[model samples]
Target: MAKQAVIYKTEAGEREILRRYEEILAGWPVPAGRHHVPTREGDTFVLVSGPEDAPPLVLLHGSGSNAAMWAGDVAAWARHFRVHAVDMIGEPGLSARSRPPLDSTAYADWLDDVLDHFGLDSAAFTGASLGGWLALDYAIRRPRRVDRLAVLCPGGVGRQKFGFLFKVALYRPFGAWGLRRSIKAVAGVDPGDTPEVADYLTLMFTHFQPRRDRLPVFSDEALRGLAMPVKVIVGARDAMFDSAETARRVENTVPHAEVTVLPDVAHSIIGQTQPIMDFLTR
Candidate 1:
């Protein structure tokens, strides 16, 4: 028998992380419904919010995170669009641990199932980091199905940096303090997060094994083929990816793409609620 893929270090750790995840879901900030949609990959978890009549908008979170990352943005986004925050498979969420090959059509097929389940022929997409890569891959491979695309600090467009890995290695021996520093440095965010947010991040990284494979950068032809309205928001000081390169490429290849490079931001681009909504709605 094939050994089941284990995302958490131990069974107990998985349970605790899930317990905390559920706690966050309990206060999802809007009336929401949860679904475990079946797909070829495995059962995928989705947290649905907003009015049923609203236009469908799919939200994909970054690696080492889940749908819960949308807590602060959901309320506002829900008012405008029916939001389906997906827990990407193999991540730390309730999704299946079946990580298909990144260099294949498996993820696009998985998303096809997800959209089919939602009765959506197409939907607007917004993603961060790894999720951004997923959205871009899908948008490129299945352009007809993506009404619009907006990515924040997305991968695949920029060159993925490996220097953070060295920094992480250097800090691992320092214990929790080092972990916190690593998170701050890599995320390019200040260490002033609320206690709840800080605690949750610590819990996630402690147990979850993040994907180590490099993201496949999109070719210029693939990017130029994007027919849908595209918006790319990147941080100038991103530690994980070359944000400037991302901005330059997207701007040059997809001439119609609206790219924004925040001068002071890093990999973690927050407070984009209004901007993203405007792009999606406009």
Candidate 2:
């Protein structure tokens, strides 16, 4: 008997996913300089954009998404800051598919390695969904490295209801239809709007084997320990977690935190270009 692989079903499946991933990257609004930075965990891939002398801003995407997801937001963000969009090590990106446990501090150390590779002492950090949780974790573990923080639909700050996990469990049986429903439930939008997005995500869902480790909740002590400016925004319609509860927790826990609940927005947040820029530049 042998252990089964989890990241990709087959070598051909991996190739096809990588091909689509490159195609998506090719369509980014701005040209990005790709770099493979060495870390103790593995080689981390990052897409670099914006001016060289500008302040550094790191972008982290949600689970199942790569750096290319920032295509729409990169142009405006690049104007004021040098952006580095990272591909999480264990996700469906070009980075190493070897996933560290979600509950461990390996991700924080990996992020530290990335920053050190870039020679950045401190920088403003922005992340969405799981990315947000990683950013918050790093800020908590290595407070001195994060100058400011902005999170969209971040996890770990508050509890993730069991219902979210239950919805995910239903994705396999429901197929594309189930996936669409799950997306709408969490993202507040139909995935079919964009042909490429739909195709790419569909392929990922069908072929990519994402990590199954449950995300851990952050302690109140960790949240209270953050001294840097923190801005948290959650969608009003987010079904994955209670946005109101998250906002309340952050606002109550962190002295310099500001929480905003956007009307009609879901877990997949949008229309945040100016607001995030304002926060990072201010």
Candidate 3:
């Protein structure tokens, strides 16, 4: 039988990506320890840090990114909470490359395994982009396990604009330069500003073959059903979706959800550490 295929375009590409991954992780600013949490699906890789007794906070990265992407915010977050930065399964991280069906509860189940492994009954959850969608999904399915929820430019809550897809496709043929331009347009900041994150995303985009799963939007019923406090932040200038519209939907559907639309920010909304921390702690 042929060897099982992974997300990368080729085995060599996977090796190269893994090499860069370790290099980026080694340069993590804050002190962290690696934990290869065993789950039913596979071994979930997590970066554990912060105080032993501090309130727990789980961090999930956007698509094509990994736990290392949280380097910018982990230090401050770790100060107030015990941080668990998880390299989402099947992404460009140390976690097993088992791509679970997006529409099913596979992700929720996998996360359940992770939380159980950590001996955590519940924890505050924060996720970016695709990770945000995952967090929301889990929270909706297992509300009692999520003490609080905060999301950054999450999908599944609003209509994804075709304009975003057109722009991304338009830039693909131009290679890395065009890809970087597209990324800048959506992410709102120059990739050069954060060279490590830029490099990692670029590498993953160049090498990895992302899953072609369609994410479903969360219904008003689901959003309104959330029992815990929910907070949402989006980039006013986000090209991927109508950030204002997203905020509106979240605000209207989830009456109690605190929504903030940051001016001049894009899909890759940054500079939200303080706002999210305030919400999480408050």
Candidate 4:
């Protein structure tokens, strides 16, 4: 008999993953804050945080995604600091987009408003891909508001090298279809239900409303003038930002920035718990 490749995949596998995510989120225990933030400029949504007075660690997720992406890490983060996971305006998240045709400055300003609404003056930021770019943009425009930053496998500029599936996901919201596949790709779901993942996508996650993930809105003047302590981590296998040249391109622009490329990882490092925790504590 001929050897067979592991092309043995099916829609059933996706449905199974979806079922498990729902179960996991429902049963898994974690530190959670149930609160809604109302802002006049943009849409208001529930903001989840851990701890009341711990140093605020703000996390911004990329497009086609929401705060729930952190479902895998919230409970653990509570041990160290107050973790604030935000749903961006204009993106497919819990936050409603007040208006469209938004620009980079507008996006940054909106983020500032969210920070203000929560009474956060200074915070540590960790973003992934598009979220990473947003984090740097915020540090650049409002340096005084940020304490520290860590951007994981960010996207934007001509620097982002994307994979086939990634390019497709960014293209459509497929909703349930997208969610099921996303879980399969992002996490190492042992044989179990992922309720935590599914609820976040269907319930808390926003795509039905006016805002979807914020599209790139950077002006050279806006992105280039930042002078803040920022750390950028890229994966060696990151089809987007996969080379030293790619890292250097971003490094050369920021005045005070550190870039690290981990060999065995991919853009999914944002979900990889350990590095992010270590970076924040340091």
Candidate 5:
């Protein structure tokens, strides 16, 4: 038989792929490293925790970040839950996408496939930044599949007056790079050494691919579709968009939902392991 075609990469792309994969592996916070497994969505990668039979919880990394942001909390939570930290499909890290999820519904459906592959009927979800946006939208689309939704400093909300050129800057080829700058621009704080924050932004821009054609929930007005448990956490010092406005939207949409504004916290709430734990535990 002829040699099988190398569909995963071209020869020149091997080094880049290897380096990126190494970064992905090294970026994780939990021990026993990462394990590769194929899911209906694609080759969904996971960082395992606790026992196999434990309650499953999915951790969604924010924009420009890998699953490693959940590092600190997983080891602690795994005692009660089988933590599965996922690299968002098509964005970056180890999610091998045959086709990128193209829109809000598609992303939701694809994520459902991932959950299904693990035989999980429902899970506790946590996401940050762009991941937060995805988590909320996913819960809205598939309310029964998620038990509780936690979003930290999520994006895709509000109508802000922006400098015309500045608005266009978000769409450039180097958008993730601009994304990091934009985040810094929004946070109003110096980017301190907050563990994986810088690495998160770097991978997001350089490795993760955003499908611009994909319509995000930010465009949608109806949040009533999501009836399951939902929680919104906005950083008091977020350099991102209007945190209070986003929090109010979740509260209004979910009705009787939990909303928290973290004081002295920046956009990377995942870095604040204890607060995240207390929120999830409660």
Candidate 6:
């Protein structure tokens, strides 16, 4: 038999990571509903919160993360808009393990099915890292379907940095201690500050295989075509992407875009719950 493809380093690792994921979900702050939406790629998991009658807002987490990433912001966001936090396929979530080509339209098609399932013609979007790239891709391809766009340290808009790989490699030999340091360097946050979060990330990186391909950069013409309101929040100290370039490109092409560069922040942007809500509700 041909070797089976898997995302986690081992089956046991998958179980442990998912077990912890479920634990986080069990403590979800607000009244939330979880379900799977059928798509061409596979079954997509969605965590729904907020009032059914409120305007729809979709949340996308960064790579190596799931819907639980929004646990801190959901309660505030859910109060105003109906929030649908989606687990991107192929990630370490309950979603399908289908890894499609980034250059292809497969992701957009899957999203189309997801929106259709929710009976939504258009909705606001908030995405981080790889999720940010997905949101930009969808908005560029299906502009009419995006009511508004918000991204945090998003890829595609700026050049992706490869220096972090060397840092990761240098720490690989150090075992768990080195892994934590590497995570801190890449994430721009001290993992030790939050033991629970640090533990989860360490567990995830130890097993999960992150994507290696470079994120496709958005062309100036494509960005200029985005008519919906756009907001981009990136950290100045980001080790993964060129934040200055990202700010410059967005400001030049997407004139209406609101760009905020946090002076001392890094790839892991935290404490933006109110700012994002203000953008969505405004």
- Identify the candidate with maximal lDDT: 6
Candidate 5 on 1-282: residue-level lDDT in tens?
111222333444444644755765665545543666555556667777768787778888864445656666776777777888887765446666444443536667768777777788888898887787788777767778888777778766532223433633664555655655554555432346542455455444444444433235454355767676677777776655567777777777667677888777755564556665666667
TM-score of each: 0.97, 0.92, 0.94, 0.68, 0.74, 0.97
Badly placed stretches (over 4 Å) of model 1 are 1-4
Among all windows of ten consecutive residues in candidate 5, which has the lowest summed lDDT?
1-10
Cand. 1 Cα-lDDT: 0.91
Q: Rate the local accuracy (lDDT) of all candidates.
A: 0.91, 0.83, 0.85, 0.61, 0.63, 0.92
TM-score, cand. 4:
0.68
What is the C-alpha lDDT profile of model 3 across 1-282, one tens digit per residue?
A: 112237889888888989988987898878888999887668889999899899999999988888977887998999999999999988889988887778888889989999998889999999998999999999999998999999999988877766766777889899998888777765665877876566667778788987677677888898888879999998888776777778988888888999988887887777788889899999
* Candidate 2, superposed: residue stretches over 4 Å from native: 1-5, 165-174, 192-195
Flag regions of model 5 displaced more than 4 Å.
1-29, 32-35, 39-41, 98-104, 157-183, 186-192, 203-215, 218-221, 236-239, 263-266
Q: Which residue ranges in model 4 land beyond 4 Å of their true spot?
A: 1-28, 97-99, 161-225, 240-245
List where candidate 6 sits over 4 angstroms from the true fold. 1-5
- By the TM-score metric, which is better: model 4 or model 5? 5
lDDT of 2 at 73: 89
**What residue pairs clash in candidate 5, if any at all?**
64-200, 64-204, 91-208, 186-239, 187-239
